[model samples]
Target chain A: MPSILGFGACLPPRVVTHEELAERLGVEPGWILEACGIRERRWAQEETVVDLAEGAAREALSAGGLRPGDLGAIILGTGTPQRQFPGVSAELQRRLGCPGIPAFDVHLASSGGMVALCLARELCRAYGPVLAVGAERMSDIVQRDFVKETAILFGDGAGAAVVSPAEGPLEILEALWAADGDFASDLCLDSGGPLKMNGRTVIMQANRKLVATVETLLARAGRRTGEVDLFVFHQANLNLLRQVARTLGVEASKVPITLHRYGNTSAASVLIAAAEAWKEGRFHFGSLGLLAAFGAGFSWGGMLVEAR
Target chain B: MNTLDDIRALVAALAQAPLPEDPEASLFEAGVIDSFGVMDLVAQLEARFALKVPDEDMLPRKFESLSKIAAYVASRKA
Candidate 1:
């Protein structure tokens, strides 16, 4: 089993409060919080997706006690790339000074990080030291559209995890994924520029799928929800996360949520939350962690990991 | 089955609060139910009434008020 040797996150310096966004959108700040439960979000004023990704990658490598030369592969997950060509992971690879290793991107929207992690788990065997990163400049993708509800619900950040087959603090036990593209139009970002969303449907599908995936993954792993110590959920919507927590019969304390402060950083969210939780010493040796994420393709995935 | 009465009962059960006095009042604005309550209510209505609630018709406006929800339910039941 591939284990997460270490984790890291890079949040932008610029913090945008709900009041600031509300004033721009001509809505009340309190109303924004009530609707999405987001208080503020970090938006990058200068950093590109690759810059944040490199920052997180460097920290992850340092924490893993592995240098860039040790990395055999890089898998990045992002919806917002700095450019259309070469993918940000290549740039991240160049920045990390590991250019020869195979580097690619997964565009599964918010579920990208988990999908990338699951993918990295497979690659870690042949490519022993693999870096799975989720970075997004989401602030560049949203518009001031009150009706679409895109403006108030996004931020910018990046997170990375160093995965290796060698002994580590956490071992990946099981992973499960499912998708229904029928709901793709429910949430999308067309090439035209601004992000579009049907908040109602996205929340409905995401909440339902997240709960189902977590249950299925836990069952497949032969561990009851009680055996799991933490539920690192994608920072989609705070209210939606709470509802999913209730549905899972998981206590609120078991869930580490960054949505309140960082909003939805798209693919960066799940990793960012997980990395923050890790930094807080939330993962104890021999403990279990369950991660779940749902996003654009109406794609949802869950991963069970045991801390060694 | 009394459609209107059944809807009222379901609303009470799902939202855990009595419907507003004004049947046309927005349930969301009145803080009676959030999106989850509405989703659960729809599921219950489908199972209880044996009708399909189209995804397109899942918006709050479809069940914004007691009267609106009742109408939406009745139309599907019809």
Candidate 2:
């Protein structure tokens, strides 16, 4: 069996309050807070995506008691990359001096990090040690004028988790993924500029699709909603989180909500929240942790795991 | 401190970017400000001018142009 060996994250020093966004957009703070469940979001300075990824990866790698060269593979998940070329993983491999191990990118939108984690687990059978990183610099790509939706929902961040063969506090039991091409347009940045979101459509699609995925993963794992001790889902929006929690019959208290403080970091949301919960003494041995996420590809997935 | 220029001074200091000495500089499109930067600007404005920048006021127009932002702060002071 494989488990999370170590986890760490790095967040930008800056914080964007709701009032600052409301003052510019002409809407009330209630509009964003009620809509997105965000109070403040982290922002990077002049730092690049690679910088964020490296910072988090180093911490996770160090915590795992392994050097960069010891990593069998490195998987980076992010919607926002520093450059269109080379990818962040390649740069990270170079920075960490991990000579020829398999390093690549996974662009599953917000569900990317978990998707990468599952894939890393599969590869762990062949590759012993893997570094999974999710880093994003969404602030740089956002347009201040069109921030009503983008600004309130997105924040800059990076989170890394070390995965290795073990029989310990975290082991992925099952990962269930599904996508609907019809909902693809529900949320997108296809306008070629700032992020464009159809809030209602996205919320509806997420609520419906996410519930189905969670049920499927739970059933496959031979567990029920009540059996899980914690639910860690994607922080797409406050409405989505609440609605999904209700629809899935999971207690709000059981779910770790980081969007209130960190907003949405897409792929980094689940890992960041999970790392925080782990640090805060939230998870116990043999406790079941449920992970799920949904995003732009109209993609969604659920992961069932038992804490070692 | 209630004057428009006072607000401009606060915005300039917090943003740490060049603005027109004349005060018509655009903060949004000019890349002089961003969402994160807005939070810092609001804190400084709140302290320096003794005004509240509520969440509803988080609009580009409020901070789009230096003159506009200055006027907003001045109005709050008055």
Candidate 3:
């Protein structure tokens, strides 16, 4: 089975308060929060998406006792990239001095990170060691006028995990992905310039989509809700996280959340929370950790990782 | 202002949208509020009751239902 060699995440470190958004939008912070699960999100200051990815990738590589050259490929998942040309993955490869490596990008909106993990798992099975990164500088793309919604739900950051064929319980059990293109309008940044969302619709869609994904994943893995040791899903809003837990009939304490502090970092959300959980010594042998996400593409997926 | 009633009053004040028919239903389950909304309520509770909310206190369980919120504020006050 393919195992995670190491994982690392980076946050831009700038926090935007709700009061700031309320003052700018002429609406109370309470209105925004009720509509969306956001209070304070991170912002990237003088940091590019590639910069965050490189920093996180270096950490992961170092932790795994491997250098950039030891990696055979780089797969980055993100909705916001620095440029259309010289793709973010290539930039990370160059910055990390892993030239000529098979580097590419994955654009899955919010589920990009999990999707990248799925792809990395495949690559590791096919080759050996692969680095998968999910990074975003959402602050750069969010419009000033829409800062209330964008700033509160998204933070600028990156997370990376190295996947390699190994012996351990931390094997990738399975990843189940599903999306409803019909609900694409529920949550989106349609203007292509900033983040926009139909708050009411997103909350509704999330309630349904997330629960279904978890059910399918657990069923496929032949595991029950209580059997899963930890739940690490995307941090879009607090309600969605709790709703999924209730729907799945899992204990709320089993879920790990960083939204209060990190907000939502698109593809970086799940990985960041997982890395934090590992660092905190939350996982033990045979501990089942579930990772999932739903966002822009109206896309969502879940992966069951058994801890070694 | 330091009582549970004060917290309930603040919940009423800060709720820009309609309250759920089942006040006992999880605010999260009823889809009545999200995280940002909870933070807004927290901020209101802090300003209204003048209590400091540590980051650890910010969880859905505390704000899942109106009763839960009242309990949280009352316990903190006591």
Q: After superposition, how far is residue A73 of candidate 1 from its true place, in Å?
A: 1.1
Q: Give, for candidate 3 chain A, the lowest lDDT window spanning 10 residues.
A: A143-152
lDDT of 1 at A191: 81
Q: What is the lDDT of residue A177 in candidate 1?
A: 75
DockQ of each: 0.32, 0.02, 0.03
Give residue B42's lDDT in candidate 2 (0 to 100): 64
lDDT per residue, candidate 2, B1-78, as tens digits?
A: 446767667767766567666677677556666544564576677887777766346554676677787778767778
Candidate 3 colliding pairs, count: 5
Best DockQ goes to which candidate? 1
Q: Which regions of candidate 1 are displaced past 4 Å?
A: A143-148, B1-4, B15-34, B42-78
In the order shown, the candidates' Cα RMSDs to the true structure are 3.8, 15.5, 11.1
Residue A150 miss distance in model 1 (angstroms)? 2.0
Structure candidate 1, residue pairs in collision: none
Q: CAPRI band of model 1?
A: acceptable
TM-scores for all predictions: 0.87, 0.76, 0.76
Question: Model 2: runs farther than 4 Å from truth?
Answer: B1-78
Per-residue lDDT value at A271 in model 3: 84
Of 1 and 2, the candidate ahead on TM-score is 1
The CA lDDT at B74 in model 2 is: 67
